[model samples]
Target: MTTQLLSRWKRSAIGSQLCLDLRSPQAYQIRHVAPSTNIPWQQLSLRCAELPPKNVPFAVIEPSDQKPDTCSQWLIERGWQCPYVFREDDDTFWTAVEQYSQPTTPKPWLLFRPCPFLMQHINWIEKQTQQHRCLDIGCGSGRDVAWLLSRQPLWNVYALDSLKGAVERTHQLTKNMGVHDRLVECLQAKITSEGKWKTFDEDSPAVTAKNNTTATAGTSPTSGTTTTINNTIAITNGDIDDKSRRFSPGVSTDTFFQDKLGCSQFDLILTIRFLVRSLLPQLPQLLAVGGYLVISHFVEDGVHEYEQPRKDHRLQLGELAALYGSMANIEIVVDVIEQIEDGRPVNSVVIKRTGP
Candidate 1:
């Protein structure tokens, strides 16, 4: 990487991102970037598996004489986004280091940091079967989507948002995190919209047949009749052709969810800050037997700092729990209404779908 570009990256928000110091432990202990992770160069091969997700921005810092070209090549071949190297002797190296400062507050990119409640119950989640599928409703900027993918690298994650920007941001963020494009599918569309779901042929070039199969397996059994249409549009490196962007699966949210993701249900469904009351009734249909559903959002308390004018949008005390309590198929695992450190009254519930 050029010094100018390196300097620019260092000055930007990406600079505070993770860094990998490839020096020996003793060398790293003596002097290294303030917030970098040390995985000595010689041990990189053994410890490479421990590296963060590809979407995370990271740079490799190595000794002056030992270039990591081979190491970089090895990582890139195994799906690690190749990191830029900074030699110890370079003048720009220290400049980049000097500019590094850990973020004091949570940034938008990190907004989906796992909820403390979820963290407390992480053992419950980890005990579930592997290769699980997850859905993130109102996946704004994909914070939770990214978190889920990072936490369960082998799992498939599907994220949806009504806003185009949010969907695009989720896609971009996941891409930046180096998530395999196949592992995540993002859509800009409302979940409640009614329309006939359309299907694509397995041989269609627009999306791989494997992806189509994965998605199709998730559709609801009652989702009724399907039509197969051959979409000739080509996909390159997981990106649709610009001319065919509008017709691409990424843009076809309804079709993607209804048809491509046919009869499929998720092992985990998450609704964070965003809430659509209409979605509550539909949650059961979307969850697999034994799947968990987590929902957290603002509640209607008189202590309004920033008033949510829409009463329908704000939950009443115990309302969140009641929504699931009435469901015979769901078992409420965790339910609480408390003022977090931020002093906002929120209702949170975690429930498991116990029956069909």
Candidate 2:
């Protein structure tokens, strides 16, 4: 393999390219290239968010003596531009591997940052050094929750998500950080406006990875007909008995909060990249007086079309400002469509509950 790219990267400025060593920790510790962060290939999905934004180019070092094609493709699918994946036996690169050590200081990009809107008003958060409660709705992968816990020692975080994988990931992240005790609970829940509720049969066999049979049943809860999960169901994070404990996917947000969360109030409630319009009206009730509501999600931009999030999932331009600005109890602090680091536009709003 050619060392032209590797040599150029080595000679370039410090921040020119991020070198990711997708190797086992044991192998990397013994001998690894300079300026590379060791993120094992198996854990890539979980750790990818900690890497630099997708726009930054990467040079991947494959695990063992394996080819880099698969690892490179994974990055590409996630909007990353990986220019090179170093071969294990590349003599030129391997010769200088142990010469340099990984940097002692944490790279800015590797740090899990909260949303920009929150950082902009970090002074407000810092002021609340005393005990406070924060709720993270749709806490996917738990980065934001983990960041909040790490940011303030006295603050307790309650994270809620619909997916089992999300809850497990959040738990794992918090546990790994040694802040799991402060994380009140990462509840697996779906917030909805529909009134229908159903119970899954606990007696049913847990779906095995190999079998991959989806559970479908007669009498659809929504339409009073039949419904089915067509493809393979990937719900291995929890057991079949755990299925019985889940709230019906159609329970209203208000109902779930009351029943599951004990109608608790929060000093800060964050809903990032997840939108449920019906849940907006209940925010004032759930938030304590003087609490802040931070919402950052994709908005309907006239110029672009997105496949996920759908049209209804996004807020119309100035929708949040218009709605919250008129609320007598809520004060619109910041309402604007900001282009984030990756160039996607998100309507970030920070509102405070001024009255009970």
lDDT of 2 by residue, 1-356 (tens): 45566666656664344677788879877776555667788888877655655666767777755565788888888788777667665677676544444554432223345676877875775574244788998898888887777763466889887666678889987775567898987776654443222223335554333443434444343333211222312242434444333233455555666666664688889999988787776777778888888899998888766666788888899888878888888988778888877566889888888887
Taken over the whole model, the C-alpha lDDT of each candidate is 0.61, 0.68
Point out where model 2 deviates above 4 Å.
Answer: 1-19, 29-37, 45-51, 68-70, 84-114, 152-155, 176-178, 194-259, 301-303, 340-344
* Model 1 lDDT per residue over 1-356, tens place: 45665665566564346567677768766666666666667866644434655544556676655754655666677776545667766766676566554533221223124555556665676576454788887787676676666663366888776545566667766654566464457765453323222222234344334443212333443442121223322221222222122223332333455665553688888887877565676777778888888888888876656555366777877776777889888899888876654567777888898889
Best by lDDT: 2
Indicate which candidate wins on TM-score.
Answer: 2
- Candidate 2 weakest lDDT stretch, 10 residues: 225-234
Query: Residue 116, candidate 1: how far off, in angstroms?
Result: 3.6
TM-score result, candidate 2: 0.71
